[model samples]
Target: MKRPSRRRLIAATGAAAASFSLAGCSSDSGNGDGTPTGTSEPTTDGTATQEPTTDDGTDTGGSGEPVGADQLARWVPVSDAFEFDVRAASYYDADLTALAEHESDFYTGTYGRVAQSLLGAELVDIVPPESREHVVQIVPAFTIVLRTSMSAGELATAVTDAGLSETGTQGDATIFEGAVNSTQSTVAVVEGVVVQSFGSNAQNAVETVLAARSGETARLLSNNGEVRTTVDAIGESELLVVAERPEDASSNDPSLDGAIALGYGWQFDADTSNITIGVTYTEGETAEPSALASYLTEQDAFSDYGNVGSSVEGRTVFVTGDIATNQFDLLSAGTPGESSSATDAPQVQIAFEFEDGTMTVSHDGGDSITASNLSLVVGDSPAGSQFADQYEEVTAGDSVSVDVSNVESGTNVLVLWSDGRNSQMLAQAQVP
Candidate 1:
C-alpha cells in the first residue's frame, strides 16, 4: 500500500483542532527563493519583524499608539515550568493576501469563508503548575493577534452572533463562552486581537492577555531559548508547532517525555503541501526511529506515523514528508482507546437507522458462531439498559435488525460488536 502524505494525515486527524484559515489565493509556482508563491505576492524575507497593518492601513491600536511587533510577540508568557510553547505565523510577515490562499479544509461553505476574513499570528504556552500529589495537570494559555477589516467591538459582536454567549467583560476585553461536545471554551477580544482558551487555565488566559495589554510585566515566550530555537528552525512556513518537555517537568511518564523537544512546520502549495519535523531527545537518551513511530502510533496523536521517514543527525531526528490535496479523510475511523480495532478484523457490516423515535441496528456478513454472542451496549454508565447476555442466533449470508424503541434524539449511542470472546466497536451514531 502506498503511504499517505503528511498533509493528508494532518487534514484527516488534526483538522478539528488546528484549522486556521489564511486570507488569499494560492499559486503553484515558487519564487526561486525556496518559498512557494501564492497568487497575491511572493515574500522571500523570512526574518522580517514588522507588525502587520490593520484593515484601515494603520499599524496602530485603538488607542492610536503604534502596535509594535514585540508587543504582539510578548502576549504569551514565558515560564520555567512549562510542558510546551508553540508559536505560528503566516509565511514570512503576516501577508494576509498570500496566506488567504492556504485556507483550512475543516470548515466548509459559509462559515469557512467567514473565518478566512481574519489573519494574524499566534503564540501558545502550556505550563504545568505545582501540585501537592503526583498528579500531572497542564494549563494552556493563548495569545493571538489577528489583523482584520473589522474592529474589536465588531469582532466581539460577530462571535456573539455566532452562537457564543456573552460572558460579560474583563478590563477592556469582551468575553464569550460556549460548550460543544461536552467541552467548554472561552474567548476574549481586546484591541482587535482574540484570546481564546479552554481546559483548566481558561480564566487565566483572559487575564494574561489583559495584563499584557495593560503594561504589566508579562513573561514573554519570545524571550525563551526553546521557543526561539524552534522558530529559527522552522524558517519560512505557513504554520509551526513546537512541543518541549521542560527540564524540571516531573517524570509522570519517562518514556513519553524521553523525546525532550519536537518542532513541526508546514507550507501549503497549490496542489500539495510540504512538512518538516524535528525531534530531540534528552542527553544520553538513545531511542530508535521505529520506537518513536511506535510511541506516536500507540498514542494515536497522528495518523501517518508509519509513513513518516525519520533519520538521526547527531542527537536530533529529522523527518520530511508531503501530501497531495486529494488524499484527505481516507483513513480509518475512531481514535485510539476509543473502540479502535484491527483493520483485518472479521468482516462484518453494521448500520444504524433511526426513524420514528426508534433505532434499528442491522448486522450482516458474520458467521453463526459470531452472531450467537452478538450484543448491544449503550450509554457510559450502568444506568442505561445493560442488555447483557441478550444474544440471538444469526448465520452467515443472513442479516438481523435489532429495533431499540423509545430512543430520544440527541442521545449518544455506542454499539459494540462481540463474538463471545473478542469484541470490537461497531458504530457510534447519534439520533437525528
Candidate 2:
C-alpha cells in the first residue's frame, strides 16, 4: 500500500482530543485558525474549513496562525532535551502496565482523526507512551494544571500518574535536552493548567512550564525535579475542556496531595447518554477536588461517545463484530497496491450517509455500537473512501444507510458497506 500522504497524516494526528467546539464551552480564550488539512482539503482556500474532527489524534487540520517568536519558543518542550510533558496525574512508562483496564479508544481514535486533520505539520499529542494501558483515565490536558517546574524524569513520573495514555507522557517527555529535543518539541505544544494540593509540587511544575516564556520569550529550566522543563502558557483567559467521557466515575472522585487530577463521569441511558466531569478545583482554587464535577453539575454539559459507522459510494456504513473499536478498522483493509495483511491492520472503515459528514472509529473496537465514538455529521469529502474504497457523490438531503455484514472469513477482509452503484471500493473487498 502507498504510504499515507501528509494531508491524511494531519487528520490522523488531530483525532485524539482536538474537539475545538467543546473546548469553548469551558470558557478560556483565543481565535481559531481555519486551516483545513484532513482528507477533505479545504477546497475553498481558507474560507470553507469546517471544524476539525477529534480522533486521528489531532485537533483541526490546517496551518495554525503564526505564533510569535517567544510563543514559538514555549512551543518547544521545556527539557534540556525536549521530552514529553508529564504532569502530576499523567502516567509514565513504569506505571503503564498497572493501568490497562482504564483505556479509552475515544482518545486513541480521536487522535487518529487529529493527525489526519493537521496534515503536513509536525504533530504531537502532548503525551508519551508507544502503546496505552487499558484503564479508564482522563486526558491530562485539563489536569496538567502545571504551575511549577520539574525535571524530565520528575515530569515523566508525574505524567505517568496523571493520565494513563501517551499524550500525557508526550507532554512530560518534552524534557529532553539539546538540538534534537528542541526540534521534536517544536512539532507540537501541550500545556497544562494545574491545581495541586499542598503536597503535590504541581504549583512549582506549572510555574516551570509557564516560566519557559521569559517576558514572552521561551526559556528552558532545570527544575528541582532534576529535569529541564520548558515553559509557556496561553494566558488565563484560556478555557480548555477535557475530552467528553462516559459517566462511570460519577460517584467516585479521586484526589492527591500538592496536586490532584479530575475524573470524568459519563452516564448512558436506554436510548441516550451524556457526561459530567469533575475538575481539580472545588470552590475557590483553580485546581481543587471535585472542581470539574461541580462545574459540570452547574453547567449541565453533555458527553456522549456517539455511534461508529462508515460510508461508501454515497451512503453511510456500519461496522460490527467483536468490533469493539474502529468501524473502518478491519484487520485486512488495504490501499491500492497491497494485497496482504500486515501486523498492524486497518480495521476501521468509513461510510457516508443520512447527511453530509464523516464518521470515524473512536475505539479500536467495542462490544456494541452504543459504546463507540463518532462525530456529528459534518460535510462529506467526495473523494473520501476507506483505504482504497471508491467514492460516489451524494446530493444534499439524501437518505442513505450503511451496514457491515461480515469480513471475508479466511482473508480477514474489511467489507465496506455502501449505497452507491458502480464503485470499485466494494470490488476490492475479499468477499466469501
Candidate 3:
C-alpha cells in the first residue's frame, strides 16, 4: 500500500448520502517481495512489522491517489481474479480525514489516470476514523499483501477471522470489513472471467490493496500475517463459474448483489452497464459455455435492449433495455453512433432493474432521493452540488438503477436493488 502526502485534501461532501474516504495507489513492477527484513504476520496482538516510513528524505506519506500510469499496467496485465494487499501503516496522523484523504486521493488520482483501464471497482478508505487519527507517531508494522484465490464469501471470512473488521481498537488497525467494492472485476461472464467486478469501497479499502503485490517490500508484507492469500484452479477441461447460491433468495446472492452494486454498479437482466455482480466463477464450470442466456430465462429478468435481440439471439434472448424498458439505446449512449460534448461534464445516471429491484440515491444536502433517473453529468464539485444542478443537494436515498453512467466527483449516485435475481425493481433519479 502507499502512504499519505502533505497536501490540501478536502471535499464539501454532497451526493447520494453515501460517501467515505481512505487511501493508496498502483505502479508497474516485476513481482518482487518487499516484506520488511523482520516483518511477521498479523496476529491478535497485531504483529507484522511495516516497511519503515520514508525518513524525511526516506519514503514518507506513501504514493499519491489514483495510481501512476506504470503501476496500473502492472496490476491489470498481471491477473483477472480479485487481489488484496495487507498494508501496515504507522498511524502518524490524528486527522482521520487526512488519513482517509491521504489514501482516497491516491485512488481518486488513480481514476483520473487509469479510470478506463481499471479492471475492478476500488476502496478509497475503510480504516476506523478514530484509529487513523490515533495510530499516528508509532511506526505500526504495515503489511501489504494480495489474493486471487478465495471467493467473496471466503475473503469476508478471512478478514473477519483476522480481526481486521473493527474500524478501531482491534489493535489490528483494519476497518471497512465486508467492504465489497472494486472497479475492474465488475462485468458479466459466460465461461468464467470475473465477468465484471462488484463492490467498490471494499476493493480500494480492503481487497485490491490486499491483492498480490510486487517488488521486494511488497513480498515481505504479504508474507506477514497482515496479508493472507488463497488461490484455486478451474478444470482445464471446463470453466468454473462460482456464483453465490443462497438458500433464502430467488436471485443470485443478496449479499453478493449489494456488494456488487456498491462496488461496480451491476444491474441484472439485459444490463450491460451493471456487469460486475454475482461471484467469480469459471467459464466451463459445468458444461455451459454461457449460462447467461439460460440464467436470465430461469430468473425471468431477461428482456430486449431495443428489439435488437429479436433479429439475433432468439425468442428467449432480448436486450437488457427491452426486458426492462420500452425504449433503450445502449449503442448510442456508449458507442460512436452518439455525439455530445460539454464543459466539465461527468457521467451520472440512476439505473435499476424492474425484474430485479430498485436503488436509492443519497445527496449531500438535506434532500434524500429515490428514482431510476440516474444521469451521466453532474454540476460542479465542493460545498454544494446537484444532479446537473437541477436537484437540491442530497442527504440519502436509494434507486433501482442497477448500473450508472458517468461517475465523477460532486455527483450523487445510488442503487436501490432488491438483491434478488428473480426480483423486479426499477431505478430512477428525482431532479428538480
Candidate 4:
C-alpha cells in the first residue's frame, strides 16, 4: 500500500467521526513551508522553541491519570509558531463502551478501524478502554495525543514491537522513529500518554507537542482568548470539536463567513442523546438565532431523535437538541468512505406484483425498515392512503396489498422510506 499523506490522515479520521454536517468541516495543511531539519520535506510551517532534554527518569512520568480534554489546549502549539487551518478533538467517555456494545459493527468496526490505522495495531490494542484522544493539526503536519493506561516502559516495548527503533528520549517520554505498517511515524511513549505523528512531517509534529507540554512554546489556549473562552464553555464531552475560522477561509457560505469559531459537543444519557453546537460570530455579524434554529429543526436528518432548539447570547448562537438512543444509527450510518459498513439510507429489495386489480408490494430482502417510515404512493395519491394498517417493522417476506382497481394501467407506483428529515425511494415501478 502507498503511504498516506497527512491530509488524507485527517480525512480518514474525520470521516470516522461523521463530522461533515456537524460544523462546517474542512481539512487542509496550511501553505507548506518552513521545513526544519528532518527526514523528508515538511509540509507545515510549525516551529518549536526547545527540544526535549535527554531522558531523565527522575521526573515524574505519565503515571497520573490520562490528560483530560480540559487540558488539551496546553498541548497545542502556539498560534505564532504554527499556522494551521483546523483543529479538533475526541473523547471516548466510559459510557460510550456500553453504547458501542449496542452498535458493535458501527462503533467498533468503523471507529476502531480508524484508531488502529493511526495508532498501529500493537499500540491500539494496548490502549486502555474508553481512552480519550486528541488531534492537533499544523496543515500537513498533525499530532495525536492518546491517554493510555500503559506505563512508559510498557508503551516503549509496544512501540518497538510495532517495528519502530528507539531514536532518543525526551524527558520521561521515549521517542521512536520508524515505519509502522508502511506509514512513517514518530511516536513518543510516556507514562499515560502516547503522542504519535505520521507522514513526512512526523518528526517536527511530535517535537511540537513535547515543546508545548514543556512550556517552551506558548500554548494556543494562553494566546487565543476567544478559543479559550469557547473551550471553557463547552467543557468536557464524549466528542468535543473546536475550530477557529481562519482569516483566509475559502468557504462561500454566507452564514459561515461571519463565524469566528465553532464548538461542538455530543453526549448520551442512557436512552437519550444530546448535542450542543455553538458558533461565535464576529462583532455585529451575528445572525438571528431563531431563524437558524428553525432551519435546523426543519432540516434535521435525525429528526426522529427529538426536537432542535436554539439560544443566542452575545456573539454566540447555540443549537441544542436530544435524540433517542435507539436512533443512534443515524449518526454512525452517516460516516463516509469504505471504512463504514452501514449507510444512512435504508437498503431494501422490494418487488411489486399486479393481480386482479390489486397491487402487492413485497419486501424481498435487505435490512428491516420501520413500517411508518415507508410510504406507498399509487397513481399520485397521497402517501400511505391505501394501507389500512401499517406493520411496526417491515422485513423480508413482508407484503402489503393496495386496492388499485380504479387506477389505469401504467400508472406510477412508488415506495419511499423517510426518517422525517430525509427520504429515499426503495422501489418504483409502473402499475400494470
For TM-score, candidate 1 versus 4, the one ahead is: 4
C-alpha lDDT values of all predictions: 0.37, 0.21, 0.20, 0.48
Against the true structure, what is each candidate's TM-score?
0.43, 0.20, 0.22, 0.55
TM-score of 4: 0.55
Q: Is candidate 2 or candidate 3 better by TM-score?
A: 3
Query: What are the runs in model 3 whose C-alpha is more than 4 Å off?
Result: 1-211, 214-249, 252-334, 339-370, 374-432
Ranking by lDDT, best first?
4, 1, 2, 3
Once fitted onto the true fold, the runs of candidate 2 whose alpha carbons sit more than 4 angstroms away are 1-432
Q: Candidate 1's error at 241, in angstroms?
A: 2.7
* Per-candidate clashes, comma-separated: 5, 186, 177, 3
Write the residue-wise lDDT of candidate 3 on 268-306 in tens digits: 222222211112221222212234323333332222223
C-alpha RMSD of each candidate structure in angstroms: 16.1, 21.5, 20.8, 18.3
Ranking by TM-score: 4, 1, 3, 2
Q: Pick the candidate with the highest lDDT.
A: 4
The Cα error of candidate 1 at residue 88, in Å, is 18
Compute the lDDT of residue 395 as modeled in candidate 2: 21
* Residue 164 CA displacement from its true place in model 2, Å: 24
The deviation in Å at residue 343 for candidate 4 is 11
Candidate 4 achieves a global lDDT of 0.48
lDDT (0-100) at residue 429 of candidate 2? 13
Residue 176, candidate 3: Cα error in Å is: 19
Encode model 1's per-residue lDDT on 1-432: one tens digit a residue.
111121122212211111211111001110111111111111212443333333422222222122222334334344321222222111112333333454443112211222221221111111011100010011123223443444677767766664568878877778887742233456677665565544334555556545544534223333334334444554565444444444443332333345555456556566565565656666577357665554444432245333566666655656655554222111222322232222223444555676665566555444343443444433221113322333445444443333445544433344443332123333344445
